[model samples]
Target: MATRNIYYKSKTGILHWLGLAIAIVLLDQISKIWISHILHYGQAIRITSFFNLILVYNEGAAFSFLASQSGWQRYFFTAISILAVVVIVYLLKKHAHQRLFCLSLALILGGAIGNLIDRSLYGHVIDFLDVHAMGWHWPTFNIADCGITIGAVLFIIDELKRVRKS
Candidate 1:
């Protein structure tokens, strides 16, 4: 009689990664909701000498690109995010066993979905975190943006490690 190794075979599904993604989305949404409830649009609450909490509505991509354009950008961005989510899901499912790769995809998927929910519900994404120094202010962002940025960094690291290993 042969003994089956359940632990080895059970690592091939995306459920674990998907759960992480869902957690990120929930955290992003809850933070945004809390910010919205406490601050009026355009209100800035200084948290430190270099950091501030502000309410901003972004209608376009990163760094406010296309934000000034007529409302068409909302639907365009939403569609793009949806497509990205689908791709991420496929990648996650395909490489579930690759822990680092799946983790990167999960973070990106969560961020994308978080922004998608905002776009679908409010016609724009809510940004609250603000960083500034020496009279220069960085673009305001939120938890979703942080997740996406971190995920992108991790993805790069994973790729670099893979290339080096080969």
Candidate 2:
């Protein structure tokens, strides 16, 4: 079964994880604010051969999905983010004792709140930290994206390990 009951063995505190989430949110917001102040839109400052500190605004989901929509995507995505945050919080409380699972959920919760704050305040998410190479460019992203991505990966890896043991 793919249930979450497998992680009732270990006991990890929830407050620390929540604190980490809050710290992530603060860092993400501060970085976005600093970059927004330093660079205008469409400004790219090359930091390396394949990396840049660019300022870009995302009005859509990951990789600019649904970006060209007729202004409705903003509310849609905001609602989705809010819903995800709520669900993630519930999971965190229920599985707070599961260290890896809680860690992943906390990171995800932080990332969601970070992006959600942007979506509420700016009507879009401000993204910097551009990476490109070999004449190819990946989508510009920010700290929140990094947290969400790493958290998701860790979640998958933990689930895999649990499944293997069972």
Candidate 3:
């Protein structure tokens, strides 16, 4: 008689994805809280000539691109985030067997949830990391944005690799 391998088949992997997503959200939220309480808005704690820790509020999308749209951006961005979260969850459930794809979805889920918390609670997103050059400044961002960007890049890379493999 052959012994069947039951360990891998018995495992339910939802927790793995959920755990990673929650961890990312927690870290992002905690950092934002620390920045909000310890750093004044528009004030920078200079860590280096190129980088600074500055507390800024963003009501729009990446880099504060639409942050000055007469205050309607808050709701727009919030709606966009909610829709994104829903879509990501569906994709994750559908492709849970794909490790890289599922991980990317998890990262995006955490990031979207992190920013959504801010939009729902404070009506704006708290941004703290600042980069500067030539006496000019780039828009500040937080961990959630970094996670989302990284996840996006990874997703693209995964797709490219899949194509090459086939």
Candidate 4:
């Protein structure tokens, strides 16, 4: 059986994705701002036994990887983020009718935009959430990173559902 377009008559799908993306970006920025003003670098506000808010600045990709490349990583990361945004837009356009797919892409787009904004405006991404176990601490991350992580998981789930139906 063929799936008739569920969202052909309206642009709700596109708007939905755009809305989510904007919301994520806004929330990410606001949180970063709050963290910056409220907490000093390396200061931690313990939230639980395993979680804390640690003010951190990341100059590289996720997990603070390659954050110390003598300042050359900013442009490289910015270029990569731009490319990712282009690809995400393409995917959003192509799968606009697929709500789950569009949503997943939108989440990722928002995250990319969030971090890209940081990279372009500040030359670094601000990370705050810090999880730890015993003496080891997980990498700190922000709302944008959370958005990306959620989006990736949602994409995987959507794909699996589609496969199961097929």
lDDT of 2 by residue, 1-166 (tens): 5777754644466677889899999999999999999999999898899999989899998998998889899999999999998888888877788888888888888998999999899988999989998989999999999889999999999999899999
Q: What TM-score should be assigned to candidate 4?
A: 0.89
Q: Which number leads on TM-score?
A: 1
TM-score of each: 0.92, 0.91, 0.88, 0.89
lDDT of 4 at 11: 54
Give the per-residue lDDT digits (tens) of candidate 1, residues 91-150. Answer: 988788998888888999999999999999999999999999998989999999988999
Model 1 vs truth, CA RMSD: 2.5
How accurate locally is residue 69 in candidate 1, as Cα lDDT from 0 to 100?
98
TM-score of 2: 0.91
Clashing pairs in 1: none
Writing each residue's lDDT as its tens digit, candidate 4 over 57-146 gives 899998877897899999999999999989988888777878888888899999999999999999999999998898997889999999
If ranked by lDDT, best first, what sequence of candidates would result? 1, 4, 2, 3
Ranking by TM-score: 1, 2, 4, 3
Tell how far residue 37 is off in model 4, in angstroms: 0.5
In candidate 3, what are the lDDT values of residues 23-135, reduced to their tens digit?
88999999999988998889889999899999999988897878889878888889999999889878876666678887887888899899999989998999999999898
